[model samples]
Target chain A: QVRNELALANAQELINKINEKCFSKCITKPGNKLDSSEQTCVAKCMDRYMEAWNIVSRAYISRVQRESQGESL
Target chain B: KELGKFLESENARMRLQQSIHTFTDLCWDKCINKISNKIDRGEETCLTNCVERFLDTSLFIVKRLEETRKKL
Candidate 1:
């Protein structure tokens, strides 16, 4: 239970960092406090960042697998 | 040797992830030019290629440095 909670906290911290980055990228100006369009942009940016993260993760994994195979051969 | 091996593996893992984060930041700037509802195919491809090329660049530099060290 403690481990799970700690993991959750770490995950939340990462999410917060992601949110901060994506929000800054998507929202250029502090227009009248987050209009509907800005909110939508934030949502989409978050999704896109997650997708990029996954893509990068998979690409790195595959590259490692290839290199290890080459090393063994 | 065992302690060194453990530290080396941990260092490698951290470096790999750090390079990915750096690549993501660079490619995000290049590929993600606009704010959109979905990540288009172009952007996806760009991100993947960016990581691959970045790794290649790092490896190439490391190999060159090792060769230089051998000569010295």
Candidate 2:
């Protein structure tokens, strides 16, 4: 029960971040409808953002492991 | 016993995810100027370095603060 809620919150946060970041990157001019080019840009931006997130997560984890080992020694 | 381990792991996962969100927000602006079909090697490297240097800056500040405290 509790776990599900936590997972939902995490996903919700990611969605919000993606929307805010991609919107600015894609939608230079707000229109009544999103043109094809803007839509394509949004998709690419979202993919790149996810890639950036993974790269950051890996770097952070490795740094943390190294710091912990240094502290113990 | 099992429940305690599960909760502990979940707590760590949550913290890890939160940090990723923050780094993505900061690094997106720094590394990404134009949207492209793929993240090129340069941009990927920039994202990784951004994370490392940010952590380094954090540790540096803390150590500097401790030294100042000792002097005072």
Each model's lDDT comes to 0.77, 0.90
Error of 2 at B26 (Å): 0.3
* lDDT of each residue in A1-73, candidate 2, tens digit only: 7689789988899889999999988898899999999889888988988888888888888988998999999
Distance from true position, residue A46, model 1, in Å?
A: 0.6
List DockQ, one per candidate, in order.
0.46, 0.78
Off by over 4 Å in 2: B1-5
Write the residue-wise lDDT of candidate 2 on B1-72 in tens digits. 999999999898888889989998999899999888888999999999999999889989999999999999
How much is A67 displaced in model 1, in angstroms? Answer: 0.7
lDDT of 1 by residue, A4-32 (tens): 65456545654865677778886787877
B1-72 per-residue lDDT for model 1 (tens digits): 997887677667656666666666677777788767778899899988988898899999999999999999
Error of 2 at A38 (Å): 1.2
